[model samples]
Target: MKEGIHPNYREVCFVDLSNGFKFVTRSCANTKEMIEMEDGRKLPLFKLDTSSESHPFYTGTQKSVDTMGGRVEKFRNRFARSVK
Candidate 1:
């Protein structure tokens, strides 16, 4: 609860560069850009290369290694002969 020792925490607009998605949230991240919202409020703009909206893992576009069915099967076949 100290004064004049904490970074300025305020509402900032985050934009996903890949998908052009914009959202606002409170953060202490330093930014040099500004964006105007639909409500006509100008806020600090923070650009992101990847966000939950466009990330492969969050959008279910990432392929799993086990589902590929080749690398794991090859490893198992190689080890199966050694075990026998």
Candidate 2:
């Protein structure tokens, strides 16, 4: 371990911008924002676009693509003309 060559790792708040979900965890990232917590304390705030709360895979809202049906239809259409 070297001294004065490592980033400052501290507790920071990550806020999900999509659903307004907030959680605190340790991170070494840099931020220029601050947020007040519920207990009248201020912490470094970081905004995120998506997290486990609103992700499609984690929330079970992912849509299955119908590629097999599309491929079968295309194959039938293409070979049907040649066969006829």
Candidate 3:
């Protein structure tokens, strides 16, 4: 609650570069871009390579680890020590 000691926290517009999805939330991130919302209010814009909207895990495009040609089993076998 002290003046001039805390970072400026305000509503920021986050854009998913992969999907062009935009959302507004409060943050203290530093950005040089700005975007005007539908309400005619300008907010700081932050660009992201991947967000929940475009991420493989969130979009259900992620590949199963177990189905990756048994790489996990190969690794375990490669380093596994035999017990005498």
Better of 2 and 3 by lDDT: 2
CA-lDDT, candidates in order: 0.93, 0.94, 0.91
What C-alpha RMSD separates each model from the true structure? Answer: 3.2, 2.7, 4.1
lDDT of 1 by residue, 1-84 (tens): 989999889999999999999999999999999998999999999999999999999999998767646887889977997885
In order of appearance, the predictions have TM-scores of 0.76, 0.78, 0.74
TM-score computed on alpha carbons, candidate 2: 0.78
Candidate 2 lDDT, 7-77, residue by residue in tens = 88999999999999999999987999999999998999999999999999999999888756787798897
| C-alpha positional error of residue 13 in candidate 1 after TM-score superposition, expressed in Å | 0.3
Give the per-residue Cα lDDT of candidate 3 at 74. Answer: 79
lDDT over C-alpha atoms for residue 4 of model 3: 94
Worst 10 residues of 3 by lDDT: 75-84
Candidate 1, pairs of clashing residues: none
Segments of candidate 2 deviating more than 4 angstroms: 67-84
Residue 47, model 2, lDDT: 96
